[model samples]
Target: MKKNISLAILAIVLLVLPLLFQSRYTQHILNMILIYVMLGISVNLIFGYIGALTLGQAAFFGIGAYTAAIISTKLGLSFLPCVLCSAVMGCLAGFIIGIPTLRLKGPYFAIATIGLNNIICIIFLNWEHLTGGAVGISGIPYASILGLQFDTERKVYFLLLVSVFLIFLLYRNMISSHYGKVMIAVRDNELAASAMGIDTAKVKVIVLAISTTIAAIAGAYYAHITNYVAPDAFPVMESITFLIIIVLGGAGFKYGPIYGAVVVVILNEYLQYFEQFNMLIYGVLIMILLLFLPSGIAGIVEIAKAKYYEKKKIYYLKEVGIDEMK
Candidate 1:
């Protein structure tokens, strides 16, 4: 009940946030943060839960962006159809990549993903007729559902917020289901899971596909919201940034992506002022976090909760004279 109340309060706050901050730039940043949160959730599924490190998510992201851009601009499809097509393309890419690369373990898998990212970026760069090459696709129409058009940052913010919430719900449900337990088993010990009759390979591929689909959806949102799709936007560096969000927020934790997205987006926004030092400072901060906070910000909250419950249990035992007996 308390949890529900808290969630309700949070929702109310988020809904009113735009009204409080009337700056278009600020709202735009908020929308970007939401998009990154979705991206972080995607990474969290494959890396955090499935224990497969991936650096090629941006490829799927780009695929989705381009899919949306091409279809919407060339074919004149609506927002929903564009997003749907983008998701299908992203999932297809995921399966193609996951089947070949998921056979490798540890750093090999990570390296394969990096190669995949590079390959996809090259395709985006060279495919002039399709992807617009270096120039990129611009003037994407605003996203619309029914007759309602998301033409303003404030409108886009609500649309994204709703989408993120729905995705979060689906993610939560998936993690709580039997398949979620299977994913954990695979993550903990793929060999053991395989010995126990679990198709570890299949699980990894499924997770990867789901993750890529989410990433692509986010990309679609980005394309529409920004009114442009560029090859440069989905670089290898952007993939790393997505990984950093989940790593810093708390991989495997429910709210990790949300917390991490807010922090990373805000930090990046401020760090832009540093220009040449931006990446340098970002690297140092990540190193510091990895060294000290290892599990990220979510881990800190988890520890606090554990300690609180432990103390409460001790107090209860003392009250019941159990402590005296011990």
Candidate 2:
């Protein structure tokens, strides 16, 4: 009930924020935050829930973006169809990669993802006819619903707001189900989960598919909003950023992605001035955060809550003693 109330309040805040901040730059940043939140959510599903360190998540993201771009530009399809196609492409890629690769464990799996990332990048770079090579595909159409085009940043935010909310609910539902428990069990000890009659391989593959699909959907929105798609836009750095978003926000916790995305996006904007030292400073900050709050911001919140409750309990005991004496 409390969580629901908080979410409702948050929804209201997001809806009213545009009225307060009319700056185009700020609206653009807000839109990016929403998209990155979706990306963070996708990453958390696999890495946080199932402990699958997939470093090539951006490949799926790119696949979705390119898919939407191709369909919209070539076939002149509507936003809905393009988005759906992008999702399907993402799922197909995930299935193809997750099949043989999911069998690998630990660092081996991580290494495979790196290789996957490189392979996908190469394809995007070299597939000039289809993906427009390094020059990228441009002039993509804006998204629309019932003839209403999301052409401006503010308009795009409304669409993204709905997308993020629906996706977040679905994510919450998935993580709260029996499947979620099994994924946690697998994350803790795959061998033990397998011994307990869980099909660990199937669970991993299914979760990967779901994660990739979510990333693709976010990518579709990005492509529509940006009106372009390029290989350079979806690189290893983007995947790293996705992982960092979850880490900073507290992966495995609800609302962690939202916190992480907001911080990272705003910090990134400000840090761009330090250009050369940006990454170094960013690394230092992350190191400090890990050292102090190893579980990220969400962990800190949990710790604070625990402390608050402990103090309240002690205060209640003292009050009870005073009443007995009276």
Candidate 3:
């Protein structure tokens, strides 16, 4: 009951959040935060849950963005179809890349993903006839669903909010189910999981596919919301940034993406003023955060909750004279 009430309150707050912010720029920032949150979740799945450090997620993201851009601009499809196609392409890319890449372990796997990101970026850069190459695709129509258009920042916020919420709920449910336990098992000990009859390979591939699918979905959203798609936007550095969001937020924790996205986006916005020192400062800040909070912000929350419950249990035991008996 409390959980339900909390969810309701959160939903209410999100719905009214746009109205409170009169600045379109501020609203746009909020939308970007949500987009990054989705991306963070995608990374968290493969890295946090499956224990695969991927640096190629941006490739799938680019694939989705370009898929939406090409479909919507050239084929004149609506937003829904474009998004669907983008998802399909992302999943296909995930499978094609994941099959061989996932077989490698640790740093090797990570390196392969980096190569994958570079290859995808190259394709986006050289494929001018299909992807518009370095120039990119523009004039993407505003997203519409069943005749309702999302043309304004405020309207787009709602669309993204709903999408994020739905995805969050689905993610939560998946992690709570039996399959979620299987993922945890694989993460903890791949060899042991395999010995126990779990198809560890298959699990990793599926998780990768799921992760890429979400990233692509986020890419589609980005393409439509910004009315443009560019090859430069999905570089290898962007993939690193996505990984940073997961690490900074708290990988494997439910609200890690939300906490990480808000902090990273806000920090990035402020860092823009530094110009030449932007990356230097960003690197220093991340190092500081990792040093102090190795498990990230979500880890702090989890520790607080654990301590609270421990104290509560101690107090209850004392009240029942258990402490005195001891």
Task: Give the runs in model 3 whose Cα sits over 4 Å from its true position.
Answer: 324-326
Which is better, 2 or 3, measured by lDDT?
A: 3
Quality of model 3 by C-alpha lDDT:
0.93
- Cα lDDT tens digits, model 1, 9-52, are 99899999998998899999999999999999999999989999
Model 3 C-alpha lDDT per residue in residues 256-290, reported as the tens digit of each score: 88999999999999999999999999989878988
Regions of model 1 farther than 4 Å from truth: 324-326
TM-score for all models, in order of appearance:
0.97, 0.94, 0.97
What lDDT would each prediction earn against the true structure? 0.93, 0.91, 0.93
Clashes within 3 Å, all models in order? 0, 0, 0
Global Cα lDDT for candidate 2: 0.91
Candidate number that wins on TM-score, 2 or 3: 3
What TM-score does candidate 3 get on C-alpha atoms? 0.97
Window of ten residues with lowest summed lDDT in model 3: 317-326
Q: What does the lDDT read for residue 316 in candidate 1? A: 92
